[model samples]
Structures are given as C-alpha cells and as structure tokens.
Target: MDPKKIFTTILIWLPSVIITLFFIPNALDKILHSSEMNKIVSNNAILIITGIFLLIATALFLYNRTIVIGTILLASYMTLIVFIHMYKGKSYEVAILIVMATIFAAYIRSPFTFQQKRNY
Candidate 1:
C-alpha cells in the first residue's frame, strides 16, 4: 500500500471512528436511562427518541452511501445539544467539539460535496 494512501485513509477514518465511538455510548445511555436523562431533557419520550435518532444518524454516517446525510444529522444534533447546554448554564465545549469532529470527518470523507461546482 502506498504511504500516501495510508495517510489519507487515516485522515478520513480516524475522526469518523472517534465520532462514532463518542455518540454510540451516549445514545445507549439515553435509551437505557431515560429517567436519568430527564434531568437534562425534561421528557423521557424525547430522550428515547433522540437516542434512536442518534443511533440512526451514526448508522447512516458509517454507511458510504448515506454519509452526508448522517453527518448533517449528527452535527445538527450536537449543535442543538450545545445550545441546550448553554441555555442551562453548563459548559458546552464537549458538544461543540463533537459537532466539529462530525463536520471534520464528513469533510474529509467527501471534500467535493462541500465545494460549489463551477462551469468554466
């Protein structure tokens, strides 16, 4: 394997894997501990739904065909969480980091999707 190919692969996948690892456990926690999550979200149903959404987004992110949509979903979700944390007077750095990671991974995966095409 070419060294350049290996480097590109790591650049593309490392952030994706990190973001996946970060969200999966949080999703499971929300689903399994809705009562605990109620302190943060105020509604158990919404918490579970968010968890399901996260799981779906993560799955989409891992799928090559649906990665763009998944990245959008994950970034939106984390952005919402960031606002919630700010509104509640909590530190939102981690949520912001997650959002950044999600976007970074997606950008690395599909750089062209983010660029406007020009007909010369």
Candidate 2:
C-alpha cells in the first residue's frame, strides 16, 4: 500500500469511526436504559426509537453503499441535538462538531455525490 493511499484511507474512515464510537454507546444506553434517559426527555418510547434509528444510521454509515444516507441521518440527528442544547442554554459545540465530521467523512468517502458538473 502506498503512503498516500494509507493517508487517504485514514482521512476517509477516521472521522466516521470516531463518530460511530461516540454514538454507539449512547444508542445502546438509550435502548437499554430508557428509564434513566426519560429524565432528560419525557418519553421512554422516543428514546428507544431514537436509539434504534441511531443504530440503523450508524450501520448504514459503516457500509460503503449507504454512506450518503447515513451521513444525512446522523447530521440531521446532530442538528436537532444542537437546537435542543441551545434551547437549554447548554454548549452545543460537540454536536456541531459531529455534524461537520459526518459530512466531511461522507464527502471523502464518496466525492462524486457532492461534485457538481458544469454545463459549460
């Protein structure tokens, strides 16, 4: 493997891995301990559902074929989290960072999805 290839592979996958690491535990916690999570949100069902959604999104993200959809779902999730944190007067920096990382990773993984062809 060439050094450039190694570097590009790392750049493309590292962010996604980091984001997955961050979310998987949270998702499991929500699903397994929805009772505790209910203190933050009123509905336990919503927490469990969100956890399942996170798991599905993360799975999609890890697979090359569905990376775009996963990126969109994860970014959307993080955007909602950002808003919730803002409404509560909490720092939303981490959620914002996750959204940026998700998009960056997706772009690197599939540049064609983001490229716009010029008619000229």
Candidate 1 deviant stretches above 4 angstroms: 1-4
Q: Which pairs of residues collide in candidate 2?
A: none
lDDT of 1 by residue, 4-85 (tens): 9999888788989999999999999989998865466579888899899999999999888898899999999889889989
Put down candidate 2 lDDT per residue, 62-95, tens digits, no spaces. Answer: 8989988898898999999999999989999988
Q: How accurate is candidate 1 locally (lDDT)?
A: 0.90
TM-score of each prediction? 0.87, 0.87
How many backbone collisions does model 1 have? Answer: 0
Model 2 segments beyond 4 Å from truth? 1-7, 38-40, 117-120
Question: Alpha carbon lDDT of residue 35, candidate 2?
Answer: 86
Return the lDDT, model 1, position 108: 85
Tell me the TM-score of model 2. 0.87
- In model 2, how large is the Cα lDDT of residue 13? 85
